[model samples]
Target: MYVLEILWIVLFRFAPLPRIWAVCLIAINLGALFFLDTTYGLVALLAALTGIAVMMVIYSRLGFVRLLGIGHVFWIPMLIWFAASLPDRQTDPALYWWVVVLIGFNTVSLVIDAADVVRYLRGERAPHYRWRAT
Candidate 1:
C-alpha cells in the first residue's frame, strides 16, 4: 500500500527525524486501536485513515512530492474532535496522554506540511524521490 511505502520512504529514503516521526505516528495510531475505549480508538483511526486515503489519491496523481503531506489536512478535523472530546478521554490515562502527544506532534506536522505545500505551490515541483512515481 502507498501508506506503507510512504513509511518506508520516510524511514529509509529520508533522514533520522522523519524516520522517528513515521514510527511515532505508527505507535500513536496503533495505541489508539488497542485502547480499551473502542469508540475513541475507532474515531481516531477514522480520521487517520481518511487522511491516508487523501494522501494515496494525491500520490497517485503526483509522485512522492512534498504535497503528499496534504493528506494531513484531515488532521484539522481530528484536532477539533480531540478538543471537543478530550475531557471525556481524561478518565483513561494512557489514552489521554496518547491524545495529548498526538495533538502536539500533529500540530507540528501540520505546520511542516503547510510549509511544504506552500513550497510546492511556489514551484518547488521536483519529486522528492526518483524511484518511480508509484
Candidate 2:
C-alpha cells in the first residue's frame, strides 16, 4: 500500500512523462477491469473514465481549458461516488491498499490538473495544450 501510493505520487509528480501518456496508462492499467476486482474499484474506474471523457468533450468544443467550474463540474461527482463507497476497516488489507492507491492517485492528479486550469483562468499563465493537425 505504501509502495503503491509512493509509486503513484512519483509517477504523477516527478516522472518526466507527458500528462496524456500518464493518463492513458492509468486509464488502461488501473481503470481497466482486469486491475480492479472490488465494487469500489469498479465504481472509481467508471467514474474516472466518465469524468475524463466529459472533460475531453468540453475541451474539444470550447477550445479553451480554463472554463469556470468546469473541472469541479466534471470531477466532484466522482469524488462523491468514491467517498460514498468506502469500505469498512475489516476489509482485506490488499483490497484496502488497492483502493488507496487508486484514490490517492486520482485525487492528486486532479488537484494538479485543476491548479493548472485555475492558473489559466486567472491569466497567470496560458494553459498547455497539444496542437492537433487539421
Candidate 1, residue 94: the lDDT equals 73
Candidate 2 local lDDT, 17-122, one digit each (tens): 6555566546543643643666666665666556556555655565434542253344456556656665565756655555556566656666767776677667
Off by over 4 Å in 2: 1-32, 35-37, 62-77, 80-85, 88-90, 124-127, 132-134
Give the CA lDDT, 0 to 100, for residue 85 in model 2. Answer: 68
TM-score each candidate: 0.86, 0.56
Across 8-80, the per-residue lDDT of candidate 1 in tens digits comes to 6777787788778878876876676776455667777887888889888887778788898888888887888
Clashes (backbone N, CA, C under 3 Å), per candidate, total: 0, 0
Give each model's whole-structure lDDT. 0.78, 0.54
Model 1, runs deviating above 4 Å:
88-90, 132-134
